[model samples]
Target: MARPRKPLLSRERIVDTARALVDAEGLAAVSTRRLAAELGVSGPSLYNHFRTKDQILEAVADSVSAQVDLSMFDAADPRDWRTALHDWAVSYRAALTLHPNIVPVLARGPGRRPAGLRLADAVFGAMVAAGWPPAQATSIGALMRYFIMGSALGSFAGGFVDDETAYDPADYPHLGQAHLLAERQDLIDARAFETGLHALLDGLAAQYEHMAGGEGPGRPAGDASTPAEASPGHP
Candidate 1:
């Protein structure tokens, strides 16, 4: 009999199954035995595709990296890096938001992951082309990753999910206002993300101008704009 057109088991198929498992039941559910069952293959069959669970998890994490848009760095104006970085951040956060289970692996620093390495190379090259020092460019990438992953992993508006009823108004009057935060939680979260994003970019913009001796992307040369006030906490 002729072999099937597509193999029954493949690395891509395994990663897809693992991604689904992670999305639905979290990373803990993606063990070889369980994933094998999901794939309708025996446990040993999985070994043909992946040596260890961590290897599978790494592929799964790269799958998330695949969702990011690196086009901003491709054959485009280098000066637009701030905007590019902003767009990249938006895409990165959106991707990870869907797969919060993969953030831990991703946070380990790209390592040998193909997609992750490509992403790092693009961002670093773009910033370096835009007149940023290698050290600063690396720092910027790390900072964005830290902020975006942290944001994606956390519930920014979780406090506003419901009224703050734990503390009585008598002694903890300040705590009682927590319920008010629940109103317009979406706007609260969006504004907060934008605020943080802008602040990070603004600081970089200032540094970029200082280093490049000219205008940074989307801003006048020597632009050192103040950070945005997204919430009551920021001054």
Candidate 2:
């Protein structure tokens, strides 16, 4: 039957299967032999799609980047770029968190990677359109990557020891109250992410206002986003 249609494997399938393998186990779990067995194809057949395991990993990382939501920043009005970028960053980090095994690999660089380049282009392009200097936009992109990768690699506040005896007041009084943090571990990390994100955005807004020479971060006369959403108290 036409040689079984070349065993029905594409680069997409290989990348997807490789990603699942990485997620289920670890990066080391992915191999041509293992992948071929999982895909029901011979080991040598995988070479037709990817030349090396590292190549498969690069493709998998790009696939993950491809899932980040960029719709918020793709709107006609660009004033919401700060908020839009914040939302996008949240989605990006969430996606990276899913595949923490690949986060370190992704940090290797975005050279020749379609999904990573697409993500970078979208963020950088939106910032430039929003009146940010090219240099500033580039710096913002780099900063975002740093923040996102760090978040993926580790927790902001580790769960505290709940046992009271673990803390000897004579040695450290503060340790006794540490148990409260265990209850709010997720809240603490989320708030810290938001706080840092907003601080960065606030600084960027100031720069944009100065560079635009306009009515600060608010809309001048008629604009979408900030103007429509700006309240008397906020303005």
Candidate 3:
């Protein structure tokens, strides 16, 4: 028999099958046998590309990470840090929302995943270049990841059932409208994300102001001291 013009199996196909399984049925559903069956190949054939299921899962997680838009962090002007961070958070949340099942693996940190490392590096480097101390920059990166991942894990509004009787006004007075929330899950979640994001950035801006004002362990000696100069365009 002639060799198939298109390869029957490859690393990309394996990762794609694994990711699809994760997206549809969660990480527990992914396995070398499951993937091989999905790919219409013998299970051992998968070992030719990935030594273990963990490696395949890592590739799947990295594929989702690669979908995020890190370009904002590469802005020419460091003053765009606030905007960059905001945009990056949105992009990161979007990628996770699509594949919430894989978030647990990603939460373990970049590990040896190249794309994950780049995401972390971009955020950390941008914060430092924007005049933040290295320690704070590290904290900021961690904070953003926590916030974005938490948001993607589940929907706050979606927790309620549309069944109006679920609220039981007397039992949960404050939640008089809780039952209505599930129907508006998307809008509520989006607004909540934006509200939280703005609040976080606003707090950071205040801290930036205080640090650059020379009242605290201000910016390094060679760095600009004035708030306007320290983090231009900060919100």
The candidate maximizing lDDT is 3
Model 3 TM:
0.89
Tens-place lDDT per residue, model 3, 1-235, is: 9876997899998888899999999988988778888999999988889999999989999999999998877756553888888888888888888899999998888888989988888888888888887766766787788888889888999998988887787889898888889999989999999999999998888888889888875433464444333321111
* Best-matching candidate per TM-score: 3
Residue pairs with backbone overlap in model 3: none
Q: Give the Cα lDDT of each candidate.
A: 0.79, 0.77, 0.83
Q: Estimate each model's TM-score.
A: 0.83, 0.79, 0.89
Please provide, for model 2 over 1-235, each residue's C-alpha lDDT reduced to its tens digit, 9 standing for 90 to 100: 4555554799988998999999999899998899998998899999888899889999998898888887877756553878888898899988887888988788876777887877888888877677765555666787788877787787645656666677789998777777667667778878888888888778777767766776444332342333333211100
Report the number of backbone clashes for model 1.
Answer: 0
What is candidate 1's lDDT per residue for 1-235, written digit by digit as tens?
Answer: 9876977899999999999999998878889999988999999998898999999999999988989988888875563989999988888887987898888888887888889988888888787777765556666777787888788776656665464666678987777666666676657776788899999999888777666665333333554433341111100
Point out where model 2 deviates above 4 Å: 1-6, 75-79, 159-167, 179-184, 213-235
State the weakest 10-residue window (summed lDDT) of model 3.
226-235
Scored against the true structure, residue 226 in model 1 reaches a CA lDDT of 37
Please state the error at residue 53 of candidate 3 in Å. Answer: 1.0
